[model samples]
Structures are given as structure tokens and as C-alpha cells.
Target: MQDFYIFAKNFHINKAIIRRDGYIYQSLIAFFMTGTGNSYTVARWCAQVAETTGIGSQLVQIKAGEKRGAVPSRSLAVFTYPTHGFTAPWLIMKYIWCLPNGRNLHAIVLPTRAGIRIKGAFFPGLEGTAGYLIAFLLWLRGYHVQGVMGVDMPSNWTALHWGLSKQNAAVIIEMAQSKVKGMLQTVLAGNKHYDGMVQLLVGIALAKVSLMYLIMAQFILAKLFFASDKCNGCSLCQSICPKKALKMVGRQGRPYWTFSCDSCMACMNYCPQKAIEVSPFIITLFYYIATVPVFAYAMSYAAGGDALQWGISLGLGFGIQYGYTLAAIALAYGLLHVALGSRIIRAIAAKLSHTHYFRRYQASNVSLKDIHLHK
Candidate 1:
């Protein structure tokens, strides 16, 4: 999390790579952001390759609101983060936005995605805009882009589906490590490599989905979290939220999600009591409320004549309706939080929530302290 780490032995660079331009790559620095630790693990593996190659290396976790000073001259910088929607997450985007100008500093982009294994078949995650978009931004910031690639790890979206078994996850992670090693080796050799061209092309076709994810879907997802009946008010999720998006509320100090949340999945996975849950009941309600608008009925009396004149659509007004949907869900969640105060109500809600019966996931190697220390 801090800006200082030397993975190389004794701070020594046993072999400094000399480029054709006469610049020597003596060290590496990887800035990574992770939720449930997949991206962080990929960054660590890249650093491990640096360590094995006798190159000095450092790791800096790309935390929300943490200041990045400047890029060191002669050091190769690597930017890695988990893919959200079809691209980079909000935390990754904000972190990159705040970095100082790269000034021709060499850099690479590695975006991790939700790799999965089902019935002994492995399916790779799609990077879509996750790789090149970040690279394009870095290039605009004066970075000499060395490579852009996608790495697949186990999916940690336990909110939507079941978590992978250990054997399945192990297979995916092992393949990812191999790719990471290869990508770093290419850069160290003074060559350029790029990957995910197919995913990028496919991602371009789905650009609208990515836009919706960034602008609206993520915000809506934030409202779906709640404390289950199993909660003990440990306050651990609140303490480790990267955006500080979780606040301890009420007499019991239970975690509450705020608008600042980007749906990073940190608070849900790392809760010691597994008290956090995503409400299926609320999701169903939200879908119906959002899709089947009440605005039409409320304004229906004048709508038959005024709709043709004033241009009222089925959504009433697309932008206004969307905004109202977000607001309505927020209000409903606020009431749900208040209702959860009663033990009987909380238990009933928990029984209806699918997340209550689902297994929670984090990277096997990742611990809550490891995440907290990263911040």
C-alpha cells in the first residue's frame, strides 16, 4: 500500500537491461488495484519475475484517494487492475487520473477479469476495453506504452453466482501466472507486446454496456448491499473499505453503504462474520420499479393529449426516469436498513436473500489484514 518495497534481494540489480536507446531498465514498479485480491496477485507475480531476474522492484497499491507523487526515471512502471463491466473499475480509473504525468516513462497495462471453470471446462474472462483504454490514457500522459494485456483469474462475484472450488481456482490462477511471467520477460528484453485484441474488438461493440456500467449500473448495485441476520457488528468491513464508502451506523454500529461506494466487492467478501449480503428481493423490486415506471400513471391524466405535444415518452423522460430510479432505490434501501433493526424482520429478509445461502469468496492467499495493510 505504501510507496516503498524492494522485492529484489539486498537492493541489488544483478542484471540491468539495456535498451537499444541506451536507457537501462534497472528497476520495476507496479501500481495495482484489486477487489478480493486477483489483480493484486497478478501484480505480485510480475514483481516476482523481476525478483527472479535480479531486477530491483517495488509495489505500490493503487488505493482510492492516495496521492501518487511522480514516476522515477529509468524505472519501468506497470499498471494493473481488475476489469469492471467490460473495462477498468472506478478505483483504477480515479487512481490513474491522479497520477503525475509519466514523462516518457515506460509502462504496461494488465487488467484482470473474471475467469471461471465449470464442469472441468475453463472459460477465460473478457478484457474488452480493460487493457487498451488504460494504455491509451497512460500514453496520453506521456508514458511509453510497452504492452497491454489481459490476465484471467477466478471470478469473485459471489453475489451473482457460486464461487469456484479450490481445484478450479487453482487451475485458472496457475495459467494466469504463466502469462504474467511471459509479459514481463518480453518487456525486460527491450521488446513490445500487446494482447486482448479480440476482447478489445468485442468490447467496442459492447461499448454502450460499458458506458451504462460506469454511469448507472454500478451506482444501482451499491444500493443492493445489506447486513444479514448473521451479523455481529464487527465493523471490519467499514474499516477496510477502500473508498471509505462503508459507514458504521445505528446503535449497533452496523456497516452502511453510501453513494461513495463503487461496488468493489471488498466489504462483502472480507466481512469476518460473512454478515454482508446482496438482496435478491431488493434487486427484483428495483427491476420492476425501474422498468415499470409509476411516472406514466402519475402524469397519465394529461398524458393522452400532452404526450403528443410535450413529448412525454414511455419512460416519461429517459434521463429523468433513470435519475428517479436511482433515487427511489436509495430511499427503499434506507428504509430496509431501518427495518433491519428488528430481529424478526432482519431474519425474514435474510431468509429471502440468496446471498445468505451463497458461499463468500476472496483470493485464497488474500487475508483481510493483507487488504487493510494495502490501504
Candidate 2:
């Protein structure tokens, strides 16, 4: 099983979505993430929920080159994959594109990401937005849509470190079922609010901006400071990369990241070289600082902004919002990073040739990208 997790919260539940074609349309598209297997686990639960609710559900296992036009209509399309860097896998995007008139169709996106540094929820719901865009395109072709939600899974790398518990799994299944049920009801109620362009635009804008920032983070900030000298260029990073962004290209035979990187940190995390250093200390500092505030904003939204009881600090709220504004200043830089980070990292390496410990290990022709799995 791959990239599987559970959502155990009690939520509003709907039973089914009967398409105009007279078929209860429900579909699950999953890309099991490596190391954790949360994708597969979550997918199973989704299928189970669809069964329990008596909804017509279909499961599609999407690989690198799977076709999408073959999928039947009036169905719930569920996507389960791991986050590469901070975004969903390219394969997922490809699959979405393969869907005929994808934008106009409603889809449920469930991504299994690096649950170590953060929860899967730490992500800004880019996958859901992907579904929204797909649904929007499909809608233009006469397909209607529902909304998106998420479920977090535990990982050895994350705060949990411990493996998922059976109780946890049970809760996640029940909650997921409820949410799916609720979403189905919303679909049947003739509610058309979640069926338009605003959702699409917002989703696209956010994903675009995030991708831009991620690129910048990797190239400008990450590569400028870190060198893959230790990299023997064994291409282990290339092998594990769900995006196939990293390829062996250097004169020394080390894997170099191309523009296709999603920044899920698979290379960095799994780098045998340990040569990939995300540094300047300032960048990490900046990232964490920025992350905290951004997380706060997400929390605020989750709390319903003004509707919830939680209140923002009087003096700090304005500052935080302003701080977020400052962070937005990095968006241009982020875009630039994505545009040139890989090239710049390599170019600088060409200019300087100082060998260090991190370099020799990477150059050793051994698998240094070993993961320390937690029980």
C-alpha cells in the first residue's frame, strides 16, 4: 500500500451522487507515495467509504503514463498521491490533463506528503485546486462539480515518527466516509456555489505562486548555498524522484536538478551525498518564520476567520498580516528561483572546486540516501 492515511473526525455525511447518466459516479485515482505508503492506505479507505455509502465508486491506479480519457463519467474522481517537494506529483497533473474536459468535472484530491516536518495539511491544498481546475474545464464542457477536502497521514519523518495506529486508522476511515458522504449530498442538493471560475482562479493562482516560490527556493536559495560535491552522481535521487526532475549531468557524474523540480525534497531527503545543503541559515530561518505566520493564517481560515471564537492578537494581527505582505515580496524572487536555481547552482559549482566531506561521501558510489524509518 502507498501513501495511505485516515481522517477520523466526525463530519457531515452524504450517501451518494447519482449522475444524470443514472450511474452513481464515484472514482478514486491514487499515486502511492514512497517510504510511507499513506497513499495506498487512504485510497483503500476511500473505496471502503464509497462501498459503505452505497455510492457507485471506481478505483483507478494511476502510474507514470496512465491514460485518463478512458475514465467513465458522472463519477467521483479521487486522487491520492504523495507531495513531491511541496506540490503534488507531475504524474497527477498529467493524469488530470488527460481527463477529457477535466476542468468542468468535480474531483476529490487527497495527497500524501512528507508528514515529517509537517502534517499533510501543512500544504495549501494545491491538489484540491488542481481538481477544481480540472472540474472547471470539464464544466465548460457541461460537467458539474463538488468541493475538495484533505486527510493527514502519519510518517516516520514527521512529528509522529511512530507508525500509524489501528485506532487512528479507524477514526480516519469514519471521518473520511462522513466527509465524502457530505460532499456527495452537496452534489445532489443542486448547490452550484462550488461550481465556478472563482474557485478555479484562486486555486490556479495559489498553485502557480507556490510553484514559482518553490523553484526560487531551490535554485536561488537552496542551490546557491548547497553543492552536490559529494554526489557521485549515482542518480539515486533521479531514481526516487517522482517528478524525474533530477538527472545525472555533471562532468563528475553527479545528478543535477533540472527545471522540472517540485521541491518535495526527495533529493535532499534521500541524497546519499548529504551534499545537498539548504543553507545560508537565513533561508531556513526565513522559511520557518514565514511558515509559522502562514500556518497561522491557515488556522484562522480553518477557524472560520471571524466566525470562530479564536481571536488574533490586537497588536500582532496587523503585524502578522503585514508580515505576510512582506513575505509576498519574495514571490518574484521565488519565481526567479524556479526559473534559474538549478542552472545557477551548477554554474557556481563550475566556478569553484573546493572538495569537502559532504562531497567525498556523495562521490563514494554508495547509497547515502538511506531513510531512518520510525516504528
Q: Give candidate 1's error at residue 31 in angstroms.
A: 0.6
Worst 10 residues of 2 by lDDT: 357-366
Model 1 Cα lDDT, one tens digit per residue, 1-375: 446323333346678878776778878888888778888888888889888877788777777666665766778889888888998887777667667778898999999998999988989888899999998888877899999989999998888887788889998998999989998888888889998899999999988999999988888888888888788888878778878788889998877888778787888888878878887788988787677665555455445566464464544566566778888878887888898888788788878888888877788787766655544
Off by over 4 Å in 1: 1-15, 292-316
- What is the clash tally of candidate 1? 0
- Name the best candidate (by lDDT): 1
**TM-score computed on alpha carbons, candidate 2:** 0.46
Off by over 4 Å in 2: 1-22, 26-41, 50-68, 73-75, 80-95, 102-106, 111-131, 153-234, 250-252, 270-276, 281-375
The candidate scoring highest on TM-score is 1
Candidate 1, 16: how far from true, in Å? 2.1
